[model samples]
Target chain A: MRLDKRAGLSPERCFNRPGLMKTDYRSRERRRRAAWIAFLIVPPMAMMLTFVVWPLLVALSSAFYRWEGMAQGEFVGLQNFSDVLFGDHFAALTWRAFRHNLFVFFALFVVQNTAGFLLAWFIYREPFGFRFHRIAIFMPVILSTVLVGFLWKLFLDPNFGLINQLLEMIGLGGLRQPWLGQETTALPALVMANAWHWVGFPALVYLAGMQRIPREILEAAKLDGCSGWQMLTRVVWPLVAPSTTITLTLLFIGAFNWFELPYIMAGLDGSPYGSTDVLGLYFYRTAFGNQSGGLQDFGHGNALAVLMFMFIAVVATLITQYLRRREIAL
Target chain B: MTAKAQSPDPLFPRSSPGSLIAAALLVGNSVLMLYPIVIMVFSAFKTTGEIFDAPFSIPDFTYVANFTRIWGETSLPGYFINSVIITGSSLALILLLGTMGAYALARYDFPGNSAIFMFFLAGLMLPLKLAVIPLFLQMRDFGLLDTRFGLILIYTAMGLPSTIFIMTGFLRTLPTELEEAARIDGASEPRIMLSIMLPLSVPPMVISAIQNAVPTWNDFFFPLVFIQTDARKTLPQGLSVFMGEYTTDWGMLFAGLTIAALPLTIIYIVMSRQFIRGMTAGAVK
Candidate 1:
């Protein structure tokens, strides 16, 4: 009874007394809340500002000047950006790298997303061992990309590697070549390796979307005499349009930012005559001198970085705006 | 929607020919996906000649020689410890601060909650890879250069957006009456958070934190850039170096890669349900 009374009556006394009890006591409550909000926001935000936001700004500003590791160099207006994009040989290298990135994007779209869309249907059917398949498929996604790079590099080794031996066993031995060491097969090889590492991500995402579809709609479409193909094309595809957008955007972004696989399989220079060079590896090579890129040009590196950011921001905006307009929201 | 009981379709057989095709496809894809991992595991045990000649055959499976060589001679153990430290400390920081920030943003009727929430979301799509140069410079300035502390801070901040984004979505789903009751009982807000919200929202939040942890543990880019010291390298960076030096030693290299991958693969298999649910839980809605 005393505890109940304390709980019930303290607030009444605190509120009814106006000046005496309310101001002194309730002010502390307000102060406590204000302090709580600040306590929560300040720490995480401070870290983001220090690392993510501030450094991005620094990178952007640093592009205008010709800065090295020691003494920041003289401001050269748009010289850095122009040089990285239009300078002798650098522009050719940039375009070649861009094409490789596009190949990565297109290859992922065809290999990963198509497989994902189909598997969502298969997994949705929940056949025997579907649950096990889902778990096992995502296992590689959980491993480090570095490890994936190493494992694939070994697998692609020309002599004793699994690829060559498998080709020989399958009676396709003549088709086998130096997979990661040839211009024709290098980018495609890396693309498949990347797809192996990440294909489950989209598969799961699309599966979740498939799961979220209202059963009533499916049943209604069936009632309307929709065939299997018609149902997939007319109803299910439209419903899962949002998943396609998310998957495609991530794929596109990942393509342009490609680094690890190429870096591991090819060297820092994206060797075999730079057939596998992507923007991320190219920027690193330019910024920090490698065997192919002779000098460390921080100015050109930052300019390339800024240019990549602009390309992403602009292209991402256009893609999302286009996709959002086409999305059939429920 | 399939959450409900399905009508018995007596007219159709359950295992139709089309599904037969799908089952075959599933089996085929599963092999393709697991093929390399199988190679990595078995090749670690097989003799060099056996690995080359009959790569398809299974090894004895009780291999200790390869493991010993890498441990005896290489720096794999040190890299593993560094990975544990970086992942553990960063995961702790992300969950603690990410949860508190998410709770406040979700619960309080603040002035700029929506704006702050948008800021967090925008961080997700922006490429952090592009900022490696300035991040290197900033770490140098703060005297955190080549330290685990530098990598820890970067991982923490880099993870905050998604962590907050997921946790906030989860926190908002919870009913508010419990929080109000706690408040009336004179439980401070942070106390309420610690005593109530954090515990209640842990499934989604920690899942988010684990999502962050997996990448941080496996990540090589940041460590490669910021860490110049050999002793400070994580598993992935160390693996790269080991691969470069031991380019010809397939046995030790396979053992090292298997060691790098084992902890995470075990977790994903054991907690696959929670891992999938936690991941999709954040993104689906």
Candidate 2:
């Protein structure tokens, strides 16, 4: 064996004799490689554990305890969960917020994802000015959601807003109302704003999927006398099933984690009789308290958060698995 | 090459009725998308009364009074500086630590490698906002509350998962010959990482940077919970408070919004391909 002195030890110290040389060198290299791996990976892993994993564990455990303003009082078992899921006042608000979230999810799926898909389809045809249209559609997606929510709030203002003025100019003045101040229109307005902010995302995803289609497949479909509608519904839709799975799962998560838009546009109370209240806003109010005299109840708040996390995780996984199963291999 | 070149026409002919309909729909959608933003920019140049009177009319582009007022009077400039500091610091840490972790995972065949990768991947599915209560309390205990460094740490932690994911994927695609050569030349592992691998990983670095930078720059929730001091507030939370104060001053609000949005908008317009690719990288993959 060639004795290599560059192993950071004298050959005599590293191995007792020549027979042990190869094994010592191999084991030393293995230890060195393991040390390097640990060195590189441990910082980020520790950061994740400290900030993410630890907080998650604390959130899970804190739900089972009585809390007095950031101080854990006693281990109350599942009482907090019961209070959030079934307590008199909490149950009604929880149900209302849950219903609003469902509405947001359905509305976003219908409006945002549909618009995105249609836009993607149109752009995929490479019509006149398609490049500019691609950029324009995605412009809003790049802006902060806070900015979009605030802008829409100003636009939907009753008197001095642009929407009302435009409605009057276009002879649709009768349709103008305080969109965010009313019970019926508030939730829908929030959904529309969110759709405007995010439609381009799914559009681009679908467009990418469309571009991946082989040219011969299109030719084959055309040779089979497929019309445009048939081509889209039959060929393109199934082919982009992976993108659909992604967009739908993300939409489900975003819908349940809905806070910023509603909080910005409609206020934390989700006012006009809580028409816009979502589980996110409800969790915030319960945990942090609001200007509307809601008390900070960390126990129930953590419980609600745990429930929200589980619901989203389970449903998102199921949706992903279901859609992934349906995706065409090609 | 010539035979392949003339193989097939596009799926839709340009003159067809269907193509025309597609064109019209696209144009209409583009208008729907761009008009509000244009109106916002124009209203930023007009007084509130003028904005109310002619909400859709083009304003004189020379009108800079609202901009001047927002720059001079509001705390927006301070918030802008704070956002820069926090985002810049957090991005640096994320890129550094993320690339290191990614390099280890991509290059080595260590035991438990896939398990560690899966551990990081789990962060993507679990939104950290769900654990705000403990995070808030922990920050308090660590004496990190209301400090920019606390926000930086949280953002770095929050950003590392996707950064590592993107970087690992990209780094794996790089040919191993160069790294192997560097290894044979007696370069240390970290030297190979920093000097060899990282230099070759710029595209994914940019992608990861843009992806994390946008969210870090625009995040409102964490600052709302962690930052109570006015001086440390980032743009989103600061603008929210500023909006509350200037509720009736539509021009000023628009100016503030414009200032808050201008950086990303310019970056997006310039590097739109990268922005789109970066933002959608997770989902598209």
Candidate 3:
């Protein structure tokens, strides 16, 4: 019936003769539907085209040009890209930020995703007070990243902070170095705070996936004398491949887009000797100068932005495709 | 099936050591999660000196000095009002324009139907911040810089893709009988959409609202870039500035942070189930 309507063939067409009035009515209805579709779809399409698509194209094109502030200078094909990739000052910063982004991606995968899966597994077991646990775990995920970042920044203060005070009380004061103040621990500390904030998201996703598993399959696995570890690795893990795909893809995008947390916790320059800098901070600093009197260079900034965008897009696509294939195979 | 006779539930073995261990782990994790926010609230009620002396102790509940100072001294209330305006307007546009687009895509089968749908879907993968340079320039040319309306437009564009995505998915699942009946009754298309279909789409609308509201309310990136005036700044950016000024006064800063976070935290607590469902709805399916 839907197909017939789309083809402009009403049910009355079969019984009635091929009359002019019928054709006129059908055409009029078609015109009305067309008008409605245009009216409905045009505004959003225009908005997207104006804001998202247009700027995207501009960013793509502007990267190859010499930009002095906002004004576009003469076209310098790939000069900006070369500078961003291999210049004296920017090359080191670029690689450092890139490495930091990779480090964050892996750290979050190991710490956050693993913790989330474990939490999901616990909830799936339906232990006593699981309902309360579910809500409590996700509490931090709802708060703004700024709030989480500030809260952790305060907690990690070397003096008069919760972590340090607790450490002294428990006779572990020596271990309480400034978490965000040092080079080695700064990035990891930011990652830990982020993990604390977002681990609940993946937990909920994994829980939803786990709940969809047929009970009979689990019962059968148990009846087969599958050990607990074997059951988890062989049965549950493979079944939740799709959920893993979702979580990992989002994690990758989020890792590369790591801005607000690091920005808030460790200042815009990714302070503590630039240990916490990521591509996001780099792009922002390049485009708009920091408090340290760095000059804004839109040319290099656009180049970096383009590179980040392409890298994320390509890797995310590949990750999603690979995981989806794995899901299909499993 | 035969295992059911010996064990009532083979999938979940209760009262085991492993279950006890899992419960303990969960409780520990919950404590780790809740402890910091609790400390923040506690510190908000204490003076800076008191906070330094007893970081862990609960403060006097009657202390309203921090709250009064923040209310009277800072521009946080203005920031809060600005956030309300920006988020509310952005949300309205996101829903209205998103629903219209989704309805058209789901209900109609015009030429380029799939193309337009894919166009919206592509917005999901490309983070808009990458285009900030061009967007900044465009906003300036359009005379929208430093304006709340500019932020609203940006947010609406940012939000519409997901809103349309979720709404379209939900609208497609709805049986077409109601629409068909309305059409047969000679009702206009807008009437059919508003009266018949829109009412049935409350679930997706709510989901989209919550999903979009959190980000719109919490976003500091755009406002930081576009909104230069202190009066126009939203909560996150405003709190960042407040933190900078009152770095020495931990109590006032905590009070400001608490004020920024309290509304959403309360809403989340009250409607946590819906919040979870809304947030995770996109990923689960």
Candidate 4:
């Protein structure tokens, strides 16, 4: 009774003002909130500004100058961009690299991801071999990309490779061919090897998504006369849509920025008439590699970086926009 | 999905004759995966002539020569040290900052939180190869060029997105009452996070360690870009140069590849279960 009386004290008696008590509490709360927000926002903002935003600005500024690492050169505004977009070697190399990237993207997105999804569906019901199979599939992803490239390179060697030997043993001598050394076969071989390494990752992802479906819902569908095919297409597929979106987005980015496999398999020059010359290798060579080409051109390199960044930013934004709209609120 | 829950227990499920045939065909895929590695490993033991002569056969004699030659002739040990240093430091930083960043985003309701998260997530789509030139310049500017620190920083920044994303999702499921009770006990925020929160975060932390550390250890791109000097090169780059130098020495090249792959394989075997669980959790989220 005494506490209630104290709480019910008139505004004039509390804090010596009519509405001061309420005003003080609210103002204090607002100050606390403002402090919290400031604390939360400052650190990340500063880091991003220094690392991401500043470098981008510097890249843009440097694109106009023919600068070496230490020395500065005459300003060449838009020339670097033009050279990257329209000049000899740059345009062709960029186009070819983009083309190769597109091929890699489609291949991984379709062949690897689809195969992975199917495998996930198949093995979901089998608990006996599931663990072993999962490990076996995921093994390649754990290995370094360089190791993968080397391993495949050894196996794909035309003369003494196990692949050609196996072909000979299987009574198909005609099938023996240079996998990485040949122009026609090099890029495809690299793609297959890459798929071999990465397919497990997507498969594992799809499996996780499949597992998220409630057992009860699946049992009910089964009792309602749903076949495996029907359930997979009609019920299970729709529920794991988010996984599909994430997998596709990641795979798309991975494919476009493909570098390590081609670098190792096709050499830094992307040999066999530059058949495996990807944008990644091309960019690296242009920026750093010095053989017949002149010393490192920081301006052209920066322009290339900026241009690639713009391309990725645009595509990523479009994908995010589309995917965000389609995301099921499960 | 329904088939799993509904199927009656069987000693050998899918025992039908036709299904048995299908199982055999499916199991054939295993041969595709394992046979190549098996052949290569065995071939490393065989002489060059013998490798071709009995390509499918086992080696006639054990050979330590290839192993000796690779370790003796190359700077692989230095590369190994380089890889360990870069991966170790990078993983440490990534986990440290990533956890703190994740905890903040997960627990707090600060303004523009999702926007901040989206900014980190953007790194996932931005491939480092595209930014190699700029990265080189930045490293040079910071005097981190050709150093392990450069590699570590690049990897930490590069890896932040996935680590933070995964860590936040894992952290969100944790009970908020514990944090509230800690706050009520007059514990400061950092104290609560370090003493209370960090202790409860071991499992996901270990999982992230394996996932991120293994890739960083095995990473080739950044090392290839930022590092040029022989002493600073990582195992992958060292192996690349080694392969170039010993192009014709198939045995030594195979040995180098095997040596580079051994540590990861061992680590994977030991923590295979956690790796799978962590991957599933992250991917599903």
Higher-DockQ candidate among 1 and 3? 1
lDDT of 4 by residue, B1-285 (tens): 346545674322466453354355346555666666676677667666666678778764468777777668779888898888888898888787678678878878877889988987765555556656666677788999888877777777766777777787778888999999976665556666788888988888887787688778878887777788999999988889888887877767777777888888787778887776655555666
Best by TM-score: 2
> Weakest 10 consecutive residues, lDDT, candidate 3 chain A?
A1-10
Docking tier of model 4: it is: acceptable
Clashing pairs in 1: none
- Candidate 3 C-alpha lDDT tens digits along B1-285: 224324655466668776777888899999998988898999999999998999999899799899998889889999999999999999999999999999999998899999999999998777999999999999999999999999999999999999999999999988989889977765678888998999999989999999999999999899989999999999998999888899889999788888888999999999998899888877997
Q: What TM-score quantifies how close candidate 4 is to the native fold?
A: 0.86
Residue-wise C-alpha lDDT for candidate 2, range B160-212, written one tens digit per residue = 99999999999899898988997776666767788888888899999999999
Write the number of the candidate with greater TM-score, choosing between 3 and 4.
3
Angstrom error of the Cα, residue A277, model 4: value is 1.4
**DockQ of predictions, in order shown:** 0.57, 0.61, 0.54, 0.31
List pairs with backbone clashes in candidate 2: none
State the lDDT of candidate 1 residue by residue for B1-285, as single tens digits: 243314464111238664566667777778888888988988888666677778889898886688988889999999999999999999889887788788889999888999999998888877888988888778888999899988888999988998999889889988999999987876666677888887888678767967787788889898988888999999999999998888777788888888988898888888887777665544456
Model 4 per-residue lDDT at B33: 60
Q: Give the fraction of reference interface contacts each candidate recovers.
A: 0.60, 0.70, 0.70, 0.33
Model 4 error, position A110 (Å): 3.4
Instruction: Write the number of the candidate with greater lDDT, choosing between 2 and 4.
Output: 2
Per-model TM-score on C-alpha atoms: 0.94, 0.96, 0.95, 0.86
Ranking by TM-score: 2, 3, 1, 4
- What ranking emerges by DockQ with the best candidate at the front? 2, 1, 3, 4
